[model samples]
Structure formats: structure tokens, C-alpha cells
Target: MNTRLLFFLLIICPLSAVCQTFTSSNLPILVIDTRGGTILDDPKIVADLRIIDNGPGKRNNLTDKASFTSVMGIEYRGATSQQFFPKKPYGIELRDSTGINSVAKSVLGMPAESDWVLNATYNDKTLIRETLTYDFYRKMSKYYASRFRYCELVLNGEYRGIYIVMERLKRDKNRVPITSIKKTDITGDAVTGGYILKIDKTVGSTSRSWKSPYPSGPRNINLDIQIDRPKPEDLAEEQFQYIKKYVSDFEASLAGSDFRDPTKGFRAFVDEQSFIDYLILTEVCKNVDGYRLSAYFYKERDSKGGKITMGPIWDYNLTYGNADYCEGNSYMGWAFNFSRVCPKDDFVLPFWWDRLLLDLDFARKVKEKYKALRQTVLTPERLGAFVDSTSSALTESRQRNFVKWPVIGTYVWPNGFVGRTYEAETDYLKTWIGQRLTWMDINIESFGVLTALREEAAFTLGPNPSIGDVTLKLPLPTPTDVSLSLTDMQGRALQTRHWPAQPKGLFERTLPATDFNTGPGVYILTISTQTGPTSRVIVRE
Candidate 1:
């Protein structure tokens, strides 16, 4: 052994201690010798790691030459799972010779990355929930989802059962694919682009975070928002303020009266398609923590689709009928409505989802997108095939894992249902997915209907990105008096017009540019009728 290896062993374990060795099977085997040091929640410890994989159709033995070897730093990962589960997930950092500096290396055909995660899948007896969820997101969404590989882990002298080596979520060309923020890029367009934020619990490590200015949906709770990228320490004051304000502005517009406006509403700041996809994924799986926690959204630079986009989905072990609480196991309801289902839960979903559904256009798009996805990636047959393939791959490894942990027939905390066998667990998952898809297909049309009644009375603004004058095409059901008023973002009225005894047909009126001193900004035009008041957003360029 080298001097450093010898020193590590001496400091971490007894001199006479003999580490256990194992022969692997069909799957890639990862052997980690931590000397004898315990992996903690924070501050990783140095370790020696080796991987034995002889490629496809080949079996690896402990005595075989290692395909890859590295000096590494390993630590316990996950929140509740780390605290309660004996089979714990781990965070890994590939280290250089000194065992201090991180070095990126590709493992098991995955892209090179210094940071990676070994998910223990303690709660998921089938051991495919996280992998399946990530795969589904990757197939359906344009955004990058974490890539994962299944492997059996041996820590010190003990076998750690089946664990997935997955790419950690971060700013990388193959990961989040957002412009990296730098200290110098703290002004103008440079500062505006590329930010990653998450709404999650603030119980762990200290990181720079802010609270939502608006309360969570009917829960009256302000969500704790954390800056995921640009590392909290590296984030400049200007960068922090810029992202913070941008989110706040999005919330403000989403909550405004004319929030449905395509140009001035929440649509102006967010990618509607991403939000739609996210909603579909969450609802399809009934993820207990969806939206409220582990939810990620990123904004690229203005030149590159500047709108804030949701995804690169993370932390999905508690999804797809996996959890017992908050109607998580049910395939009948929308996951975004968790606040209403579990009002007393400490974490509440952000108001953005409910408000977004309130917009007719957004709801229509969501329905259409879900309908389209069902024909492709979200189909029952395709999903079932993926589950079966993954189950087959892990058939041998799972027996070994269950022998080590013995959680197969028993209930893990928060598990909605416990199966007597691994096959049963997977069957339940498939059944749940089928039911969920059917429920969504039958009920998703309601989203389009929920806001249509209110929108029917609203007028449509034409030449929306109007250069000068704009036309309003109003469909009146009956002759009545109508009052029109335009207001700025701050709710300050800019212009007012009245039409008395308007015909029941479509009424078209052109508002002259000179009527209001317009430059470049967002204006809300409200039309008050006897039935109710309706509003539309107008953009002045």
C-alpha cells in the first residue's frame, strides 16, 4: 500500500482488522474502503474506492482488476432517509491523489462528474422508483434529468445492497445546461440569465435563501426558496438580489388580476410548456413532496430562452403511490392540490400552480400537452415495459439486497402499501400508474373548463405586442353597458373608456396609441360588465 493509504488505514481502523471482500455478479460492483471512518451528514471523509465491471454479459469477482479506482470523499446523503433509514444513501466526491481536490471521472459509461449520489432506495422496495421517475422525466421533457446507473455497493467490510449511482444536480453542460454565474457577471443581461432555485426545507446546511413574498396556496405560508446554483458563498449580492426580485416579480404577476394575460402575466416570465410538463409528471406520479419540496426551476440568459423553466426533477423516492400521507397513494387526485388535501402539513405548495391553472390558455395547454404525452412517453404500455425491463435487470441483485436489508415484505415508514414480494411491489406500481393515467385522462378536461366560464365574458386583445394602436374584440351575450380601463403593473389606472348599450354581437373597438402615453411596458385592460369584471393584459412595445 502507498504511504497515504497506509496512514488512512492506520488512523481509521485497527491494525489487525481484516476488511471483508466480495465477488460480484452481472451488475457493476462498487467497492468503497472507508478505512473504518463513519460517514456523517456533513463534511466528507476520505476513502479509497474501486469499481469492478467487466462489461456486458460478464461477471466480476473481488479478485479481478478494478476497472476504475479513485481516492474519494464520502458522506451520508438525504434528509429523512439519512436520519431514520439504516440503509443510507451517500454523496460521493471523486478526489485526486492528495485526497483533497475533486476530480471528475466517468464511471459505468455515465458522463464525467466529480459529484455523484448513491441512492439507497431504502423506502422503495422495488428499488426502481427514483430511476423510473428520472427516466420518465428525461423522455417527456426537454430539460435535462439526472442520469443513473444501478450498482451494488460494498462499504468497508459490509455489503451496502443495491444502490444507484446517479448524476448530482448542478450547473453543467450535460446537467442543468444553464449559463454559469460568475462574480463579474453581476450586471445587465449577464446577471439576468442562468439561475437555479429550489423550494425546499431549510433544516440542513447553512445556505443563502429568501422567503416568497406571497403566501402559499390558501395555506398562508411563505415558502423558503434556496439558491441551488452559483453556490451561496459564490453568489454576489447583485446576483442574489436579481434572482430574488425575479422570482418575486413572477409571483406578483401570477397573483395579479390580469394574471392570464399572455404578455404581461405569469406567461411573460415563465416557460408555460415546462410548467405544464411538470404538473403532468407530478400528478401522474402523485409525488407527495412534488411542488412543495425538492422542486427546481432555472432561468437561462435572456438571449437563450430567458423564461424561467421548471425541472431537472429531483428527489422522487416518495412518488408514484410510495407515500401514505397527503393522498400520495391515490391515483384519483391532482398532486398540485396538496395544500387543500393536507392543510396542516408544515410544507405547503407555492401558489403558482393553482393560479396558473386559473388561466384559460395555460389550462388548455396543460390538457393538450398531457393528452399528447399519453400517446407517447406516458402511455401505459411503454411505462410498463420500462418497469419490467428494470425489474429484470435487478432480479439477481435484488435478492442479494433483500438478504442484506430484509425490507421487502415489511412496511417502511411512509410506505402506502407493503407487498409480500418484490414482484408484487412492482405490480402495485404498474396498477397505480394505470389508474392514475385513466383518472387524469378523464379529469384533465376539467382544467380547461374551470376557467372557461369566467373567460367567456373577457375580451380578446389583438396585435398583443402592439406597436401603436390596439383593437379589443369583445363578445357580448346581450346589450349592456361596458366600462373599460387600463392600468399599469402597480394597479394605477392609465386610461378609461365607456361603451353604453353595446350590441350582443362581437364589438370591435380600436384604442388609439395617443389615448395613452405608451412606451415599452405591461398594461392591464379591465372590462366591467353587468355579469362580472374581466381583464386582459396588453403589451406595449
Candidate 2:
């Protein structure tokens, strides 16, 4: 093929350019030859890094050995007895002796950033879920999502696999745009905001970690929510409390009786647009571990949005019908509803989504956003095109990657579904996403019915995101059946209390911390009336 035609083929249909030279496709090839040929499971290891790209040449193709660390989550571990599958995820930080990011030139079209993540999409046979998810989020108008490039990775002079060369989630101007908090600036707005947090299972503890003050769902599970921006040790107590209190207050609004109140409800704390976008994306993919695990939220300075914002989606390897566990393989359900199916899982999704969906205004926004996006990004034609182009781009690299690891036609943990070929995996994803979009289209049309019903019996809870006892207060609109029930975040009723009908007036009920079997997490407090049922979110100590 002519050079121009080959370039066009690589650009429009990368799969068609399989016979083309690696340099012709303009894809960066990263070569990591470990120093002294030693690779360890320990994250403290450093490795020599080099880049060979057909595009912009760097000042130095080689760099001072960068510190390398093994990156493993609860599912993917360090090593296993599985055959011919030694590839593991890794994190690379390029630093100078001065402990600053080396001011190096750009590599592989990405600007030089000290932190980079080399994702080992081993379990994801298609290898495009993470890439596709990230791209979709970036296309949205909300918070900044990570930028990535598809590249072939070579380790120890051997082709390990195809890996995504991407920017790590960090507090940078180009990444999570937020005000930086200095050690001395912990007193005011500088310290009070711009914090990145992950609501997920604990990886390891740094200096700073806190459990949710309330139970999360029906199981009353209190999850370990970690602070990602300020290393726990480096973060001061006052600064920590400031951000934590802000989140607590936000939860308080979400759990309050007047939650839908314009000035006092959860809407006051979170950017509604951002939340809507986040929910749509999460539901669209039906990501199994989405809201419960690998969930990221960031808060900016009081001068900025000044509230906790859901953003910059991370760790989507098990999404897009890729995982067999937790109904991830099914395209007809919502991922946020994970608690409804697996109520007792260690990492339960927070009740935030459930409560948010209860608001008709919020639900309508989500519905509107979904419909709008379908005309654009989420449309079948556009989404299918993305899947096709991406699959084509990775065709040759994927074959090489699978050959190296050889997990094809084999089952991987949490893989709700599996396919034997790369094409099969891509096809499954495309089909599932299409079906998911169709389901969401219909469900969102009637999204407000639940919200409207809940409003008819609206009530309030106090000291939400609470640690211990909670008091619920409601007004008896009329003399009708009055019964109160407590539920975990997933809406599974845990305890129910009934009250005899009384004249219209203020009514109060106290729920001690012990009343909720699960402690220090989020739970729902609902009041059922002859008209309908209304609920509020409460946190137990």
C-alpha cells in the first residue's frame, strides 16, 4: 500500500493495516528493559524506560531509571499459578533527586508528566473497555478525565502486551483542576477544599483514611473511603476535618427530610450537572464495581464549585458486559442498583445514587442528558463506530498481547461473560451497550414516577451522614396509615416501626445507632403513608 493510503487506513481502519509497519500507524511503542534484568512484585522497584515513536522525537529517548511499583487491586493480585501470564499492572513516577517531576520533553503525543499508569487489561480480552470508557467521559463537558494513548508495551526486550499509556489521576492543572493546598495553608479555603477521594475498598492505609459515618446500603456496610490527593500523612488534621465535614454536610443534605429543598437539600452540595453525567455514564456501562468500588469524587476550593463532585472515572476493566459477577454481564439493569442484588458484598455501593434518583428533578436531568447524548456520543451509530475503530486499532497489538498471555478462551475471575476471540469480545461489548442504551431509554422516560411517589410522603432526617443516633421528623398531612421503616442503602427494609394515626402535626421518632444492625454507614429511613412512601438517607456511627 502507498504511504498515504496506509496512513489513511491506519487512521480510519487500523485493523486493515495489520500488514503495515509499526512505524506507519504512528502508534508509540514503549520499551521497558528492567535494570539488571530484575523485576519484582514489590512496587519499590525502578526500571529503565525508553520510547520509540514515529512522531515527535523526544530530547532523550531514554530516561534515568524511573521508580516502578506493582499495581494490584482486590481482584488482580501480584502473581498466580496461571500459565504464561506474568504481565501485571504498574505505576511509574519519573522524579529527580530533588523529588520533583523531571522537566522532560513529551513522549508519544502525551505531555511529560511525572506520574503515568500502565494498565494491564489482562482480564478484559477486548482490551478496549477502559479506553472506551475514558474516551466517552472525556467527551463529556464536565470534569477533566484522564488522557490516554494506545501503545504496544515491550518489557525486558520481550513484547508483554498492549497497554494504555495514560496520565495518572492526580491534582494537576491538566488533570483534576483544583486549588492546591499547601502545608501552611491548611487554615482557610486553601486547605478546606480541592481534595480527591475514592469511595472504594481500602488498598492500603497512608496517614489519612476514614470510614463513612453511615451505613452504605441494605447490608448497612460502612466502606473505607480514602483521600487520594493529600497523602494522609501530609494532610493536617484541620484540613482533613474541613473536607470530611464538607462531605458529611453534603450527606446530611442528602439524608435530610427537606432533601429536595432548593437551598437546603443535597442539590446545595453537589454540582447537579456533574452528578447527572456521572450517573448516566455509570448506568450506561452497567459497571459492576462502579459506584461501590473504583469510584472517584473530588472537591474544589470554596472559590470554585466548593462541593464534592463526581468525576474522572477510574478502573473500568470489568465494565461493558466484561464481568460475569454482580450482573455486570447483563445489559438490562442499572449498575447503581448493585445493592438490590448483592446486598452483603464487602464493597457496597453508597446510597447516594439511590437517593439522587428519588428526586424527580434530578431524575429528569439524567433522563434528558441520556437522551441528548444518544443523539451524539451514546447513539448507536457513534458508539458502534467507536467500538469498531478502536478494535481495528488494536487488532495486531491484541493478537500479540493474547499470544504473550494466552488467556483467550479461558475464564477470568469476575468475568460474567467470556469470548474466545478479540472480535467476539468486541461484538459482545457492542451488543450489550446497544441493549443497555435501549433499556435506559425506556426506563428514564418513566424515571420521575418513583420520585413523584416519594415526594407525596416526603419526610426529613437530621444529623445525616451521622455516626450514631438519628431522629426523623415528619408532618402528618392527614390522619392516615403511618409506618416508618429503616433500610440499608440498597432500599432493603431492615426494621419497620408503626405509629397510630394522629391529627396533622409534627411527629418525631428516634432511631438509636444500634437499631441499624450494620454500623457507621448509610441507611435509608422511610415513612409510609396512605398516599405513598417517602424516604431519607441516614448515617450511623
lDDT of 1 at 258: 78
- Residue 56 in candidate 1 has what lDDT? 90
Per-model CA lDDT versus the true structure: 0.80, 0.68
Q: How close is every model to the real structure, measured as TM-score?
A: 0.80, 0.76
Instruction: Mark the regions of model 1 whose C-alpha exceeds 4 Å error after superposition.
Output: 1-22, 450-541
lDDT of 2: 0.68
- In candidate 1, which residue pairs get closer than 3 Å at backbone N, Cα or C atoms, i.e. clash? 193-301
Q: Taking the tens digit of each residue's C-alpha lDDT, what string does model 1 give over 1-541?
A: 2344323322212224334223556898888988778888888999999988999989976657889999999999888989999888899999999999999899889888899999988998888888888888889888788999899887775567789999998888988888987978988899997788888888884668998988664336777988888787788999999989998999999999979887889989998888988988888888899998889899999888888999878888888899998678877666765665555677989878867776767778888888989988898788888999999999888877776777877899999989999999999999988988987776665555533354455568878888888998777655544566676776455676655445567778898887557567888776654333467888888
Candidate 2 lDDT over 405-438, as tens digits, reads: 6777778776767777777777888888888787
The most accurate candidate by TM-score is 1
The true-versus-predicted C-alpha distance at residue 326 of model 1, in Å, is 1.4
Best by lDDT: 1
